[model samples]
Target: MNPVSVTDYRQLAKKRLPHFLFEYIDGGSYAETTLGRNMADLERVALRQRVLTDVSSLDLSVELFGQSLSMPVALAPIGLAGMNARRGEVQAARAAAVAGVPFCLSTVSACSLDEVARSTAKPFWFQLYMIRDRAFMRDLLGSARRLGCSALVLTADMPVPGSRYRDYRSGLAGAPGLRGNLRRVAQSVCRPGWAWDVGINGRPHQLGNVAPILGNNSGMDDFFAWMRDNFDPGVTWKDIDFVRGEWGGPLIVKGILDPEDARSAVAEGVDGIVVSNHGGRQLDGVLSSVKALPPIVDAVGDKATVLVDGGVRSGLDVVRMLALGAQGVLLGRAWAYALGARGEAGVTHMLKIIAAEIAVAMALTGCRNIEAIDRDILAELGQDINSRL
Candidate 1:
């Protein structure tokens, strides 16, 4: 398959990856109600069409955090990206640099910060998860600064990991001990292409970022055990103060979905807030990011940059988010699917498809640029909300 759309890339990824790894990337929390709703609610948004508008000169560029972006989209952080392809984070960072957009590296990434920084000329953003080890967190911040990271994204969602049943059922969580490990190996045997490309050729299969702390020879089960032991569940607002004091650069609080939390984030002096539900991987029944965006935008006003992620599949979905009051959109599974399907080339193709789609959507909607996209482009916000209910 040529794979023109993100969905096509996803199908390709499913076929190329082992069953356990594929389910880990594609599945969500228990019941997956919010996961399904994120995309469904985005489809519910109606776009207004107009003709005879002069859109001959279209600019997809936008300024984010004092940096000019070729488009108002960034790749969201995803763990175990290296498992998808050999040195996947490095490949994804290069793709983002070529596309002229930001790529946020996950704390649990397969590649180290220094490796990615050395590979790309453009400085990329780093995403942090506040674990129980305060000294380690502080040192990680120092490392990010020394590497010249453009921004620090503090993901406030997963104080504890969500209950993803798919992970358990697929033997991804190493639940059934030796039996599960044997099952995973058997599944890998079925997909010899993936086994050779990722399992054999993708050497250094451990989590690179935490290798120094958790040993370089650690495996997926060891990383999971470390996360289970160290993820701090007692974090509070004061922890934000600690992060602010340590990192002097732009700090974005991810996983914010409530207007009250948005107000508190402004009060806490965050540079930006991502209206996300951890891409519906954390919470199960919460409102979709789009439905949760308007009130948060109303609450924060211009005090902070309000970006969004979750169920953003295409450029039109990006337009719908901008119309609903998001300054930018972060793509999670979309880019991951592409990366797993065709490595860096697949990622570059996916970005081009989205950019072209956004241009066409902007031309048809009578909007000349991203700034012209507002709530008015959406057909009756009240009716759309009612329909979702």
Candidate 2:
């Protein structure tokens, strides 16, 4: 496949990657209702077609947290991202830099923040999971600060990792000991491309951020074990101040689905709030990010920077998110699939595909610029647009 669309890239990724790796990026929590809703809802969102409007001179640019973006899209922080390709996060960061957008590196990414910073001088964002070890958290924060990271994204959800049935079935999680190892080996062998590209060649397979603490236990087992042991479930809003004190940069709180929580994030003075359900991976029964967006926008659009993620599969979907009132949209699975399928070149092309889609969508909607994107561009506002299309 030439992979002209993100969906095409996803198909390519499925063929090229091992089953466990594909499942890791593609699957959601138990039932995955929210995940389905995330995509279905966005697809049903109709864009109002306007005729004879002067959209010839279009500008898709937008500025967030003092950083300029070619479009309102960022490569979201995804764990084990590097395993998808050789130094996947670094490659994605380079693509983002060239595309003039932000790439947020997950703390559990295959490549560390230092590695990405070294590879690309373009400032990237670092995402932090609340770890039980506050000292280690401080070290990570200090590293971000010292590396001149443009922003710090603190994921507020996922204190307790969600129960993903797909991970267990695919042997990425739960299945352990010799049998699990054999299963993963067998799966990797089935996809020889992945085995050679990542398995044999992608050395030191350690989850980079915590590699220091992992010591000799630096493998897939330690990656999951460390997350299981260190994830802090008892976190509250006030705990953010500890992070606020440690770092001085644009602090964005991701995974806010409720307006009350969005309001609370505003009360805590976060620079931005990513209206997300962790891409429907964390909580399965909650509202989709788009479904949760309008209310949250009503609650804090004026107060905080509102960005959204989940089921943003296309550039039309990007415009849909912006129309629903997100200043930006984050690409999690979209970029992950692209990287797995084609490496840096795949990422670069995926972005071009999205940019083209956004431009076309904007031109059709008669939106010449980002500021013109509002509820008005929606085809029909109150016609019960929530049903699955």
Candidate 3:
């Protein structure tokens, strides 16, 4: 296939990856109601078209967190994301750097922080969860600082992991012991391309950052068990202080869906807020990030930068998110699918597709720059951004 769209890349990814790995990236929590809503709600937003406007000149650039972004986009932190390709996180980071955007490496990434930092000339962001091990967390932050991390994204969700039935059925989780490993191995055997590329040749199979604690454990079962034991559920806003003590950078809080929590994050001094439902992997019935955006934007005013992620598959969706009042958009699954399908080249192509779409959408909508995007670009211009969120 020509693979001009993210959907095409997703198809390629599905065909090349083993079933368990594909399902791990593709599925959401039980029932996946919010998962579906994210894309559906963005599609529901109607763009107001204006022809014959002077859009001969267009600028997609935007300044975010003191960094000038080629576009208002960043790669969201996805757990086990690097599993999609051999040294996948490192490959994606290189792509993002070349494209002039930020790539936030997950705490559970396959490639360690130092490895990614050393690979890219532009500093990437780091995503952290408040695990039970504060000493470990402190040391990790120190490393990020030494490596010159540009920003810190605190994933304030997943205090307790959500229930994903797909993981259990595919042997990605739940099905432990020899049975699950055999099932995954059988599935891998069916996809010899992935087996050779990732299974046989993919080096440093364990979660790199936490590998010290994991020791000889590199299996999915071991990762799940570690999360079951280490993820801290008693975390509160006060915990941000501990994180602040270790490093100083733009602190972004992800997984916010309510205006109240948005206000609270601003109160605790978050530099940015990502209105998300963990790509619908953490919560099943919550509102989509698009639906949840307006009120949070209203609540925070200009106190912090507000970014939205979840169901952002194309450039048009990026325009829709900006029109709805998000300062920028974060991409999760789109980049992952691209990475799995064609490695770094696929990621670069997917981003090109989005950038082109954004340009066309802006030209048609009578805007020549990113700053001109607002509710006015929506068909429901006078409706106050539909604040029922």
Please report, in order, the local distance difference test score of every candidate based on alpha carbons: 0.90, 0.92, 0.91
What tens digits encode model 3's per-residue C-alpha lDDT throughout 1-389?
98999999999999999999999999999999999999988888899999988999999999999999999999888888787888899999999998898999999999999888888899999999889999999999999999998999999888999999999989899889999999999999999987888888987788989998999988889999999899999999999899988888889999999899999999998899999999999979999989988888989999999999999999999999999889999999999999999999988888889899999999999999999999888886555666422
Candidate 3 clashes between residue pairs 3 or more apart in a chain or in different chains: none
Could you tell me every candidate's TM-score relative to the true structure? 0.97, 0.98, 0.98
- Alpha-carbon error at 63 in model 2, in Å? 0.5
The number of clashing residue pairs in model 1 is: 0
Q: List the RMSD of every prediction in angstroms.
A: 1.4, 1.4, 1.2
lDDT score, candidate 2, position 276: 94
TM-score of 2: 0.98
Q: Predictions ranked by TM-score, top down?
A: 3, 2, 1
- lDDT of model 1, residue 271: 94
Error of 3 at 9 (Å): 0.6
